[model samples]
Target: MDVSWAAFVGVVVLAYLIPGPDFVVILRSATRGWRTGVAAALGAQTGLCVHVALAVGGLSLVLSRHPDLLTAIRTAGGLYLLYLAGRLVLATFRSAPGPDREEPAPGHGDRSAFGQALFTNLLNPKAVLFFAAVLPEFVGGPAPTWAQVSILGALDVLLGLVAWSVVILAGARLGRLLSRDRVRRWWDRTTGATLGVLGGGLLLARD
Candidate 1:
């Protein structure tokens, strides 16, 4: 295969090592149930498909040429993150759960988790930027750029799914400890605050 995938694999592995919004969503959902966490992972990866499609279609290059477009996207994504954070924070104020609320069954709130995870990943401009800027450098094969990017981007998403599954497995084990009302309250608060910070950083960051 002419695809220079060694460096690309290295990048993907490094990315898996780092934590991002997806990580927070999966682990949080797992606190509800491992099944919920799996749904969240699916939604997140589906959102990743949009970014990959954009990169494969060369829309990323267009966005790069027009910084304003990217800025607009980044702003929207940041605002969305802020909105999710606000909701999480407000939820903390609600009447507390019993000592250990039974871990939710598979169907309960799984759809909601998936929806939230999908949008969280879909709206982030940084993802497309990575696909546009970093992905191209790794495309050295004589094949069409679109073809190469499709394969490379697909690999990234596949690896992401595997990584999230591993996280979900670990988080399911931790979910037992986190199920206590007091701990969950604090956990939600911390995740909310972190999301707020990330959103603010995105909005303030210069191109």
Candidate 2:
């Protein structure tokens, strides 16, 4: 294909760099341990794969053509974000060991985190729209549209993984700081507020 490799890479890199719910989720998981952090990142990427599949199979086009379907997805996504926010806020009030206590080793939490991150990405209508709007830009080269789109989608996933790995690793380094009960409580409230704001923004978003 005659894709603009440099341009595509630059755009994708910049997009991944912009922190969002995905970043928040990964960062929060990182506070638990490397395994949870990686699981969260993988789950998010896996959700992106679903979007890519939908885009490739023309499902995204169908959704784009049907405003109702798009609206439904967006509403669900927004509500889910609100639910997540509520959970985070509630976490701040839950009883837990003091910060000085030894941190628990990561376990089943990683599995649930993977699912949470996966659904978080999947429910995001913006991500679906992103694939629909941006993938086509690189589809008119030597290769067929499907092939080009597939390649671009793969690249997006790869870059996303790489970018999130950095976030997870860096956040892991700060795990000790985050483990502090006071700091953790503050972080939970802050993140909860951020999620609530984002949910509200998405709920009011227009097509």
Candidate 3:
């Protein structure tokens, strides 16, 4: 019961608010439809669940101790992001033009959206480091360490889901404009470029 609830929420909220691959994926997918956006949000939280499990079970600590494993994961994530970026950029150039489109049919491509979001988050070194490093800072008093970590992780996931839901709604509002082929293409290119930069940074970042 000695948890720093206020500080925990504040930090988690700030983390979610930062622009990252998860945010970009949800925002971009929202432009197509609400289903995609929601799926992506769910996917991201699911990945967060994995992180929470790791933190609660103390595996995250193990990962932090093994620098090589962390580096491997980081490299893989960076490569994956670059792959996604290249796909988006190439598709923009290769696809033929089309008229403005309606929201995609329900369930159509939702699986892909979800999977993309899942890895976008699951492979994130930041998430791994956050769990190993930050989540422990809020633990205090006589409570069990796992219990405290579980509570903090749950709060993080809840706040993140809510924040992303709001972002999805906002992006959906802009769908009308983005539905235009030229605009959507440009948007994809922009996100693709962003992912590319993030990937490169992650690859180049120091421990």
Candidate 4:
């Protein structure tokens, strides 16, 4: 195979290292607990698997060829991001009636966090396009195109998992430091604003 495994690994490492929605979700979930963070990470990986399947099936090319379809995906993704942002913002305003000493109810169940992470990754058009563009670069090699793409896609997921694991662990450490009610409030607001901006950016994105 003509594929440069080293280069591919380097690129995947860089991509996941850059902070994005997936990173944010994993960090936030980790703040709640490691279990939630793991769930969110797994969920994101599951979404990546979906994209890999699409790439292997050649649907990524089809979407690229059809701008309208890509636009549709972008719009749906943007709306979902906006929805999540709104929820975060609203959560910041909500006051728990109980004392601060009482631990806040768990923010989200594992299933809920998983679903959120899955949808967040799946809705991201950039991820789809990334796979579409990059997978082909390694495809013309001696090994079958499908096999190469699958292997590369799996590598992508593996890199993402490793990167997110670090993010989760670090966030968990930070979460402990910021567990106080006042600090937690500010953290929520910051994350909410970040999500809002990302969603708005996605909405304005042009193909």
Q: Pick the candidate with the highest lDDT.
A: 3
Tens digits of per-residue lDDT for model 3, 96-192: 5545644222222678789888998998999988998888888888989999888888888889988998988987898778756678778888988
TM-score of each: 0.91, 0.91, 0.93, 0.93
lDDT: worst 10-residue window of model 4: 97-106
Residues 58-148 of candidate 2: C-alpha lDDT, one tens digit per residue: 8657866886887887888889889888887876676676557643322228897798789889988878878888778777856777777
Q: How do these models rank on lDDT, best leading?
A: 3, 4, 2, 1
Stretches of candidate 2 off by over 4 Å are 96-108
Please, what are the lDDT tens digits per residue for candidate 1 over residues 1-76?
3765778888987987888777887788877788999999999999999888988889766976897988888898
Ranking 1 against 4 by lDDT, winner = 4
Give per-residue CA lDDT, model 4, range 1-207, as digits (tens). 688888888878878878888888888888888899899999999999999999999976697578698788888888887888778767766765357355343346789789989999999887988888866776665688888888889989988888888988998898897767778877877887887788888899886
- Please report the TM-score between candidate 2 and the true structure: 0.91
| Candidate 4 global lDDT | 0.82
Candidate 4 clashes between residue pairs 3 or more apart in a chain or in different chains: none
Q: List the residue pairs that clash in candidate 1.
A: none
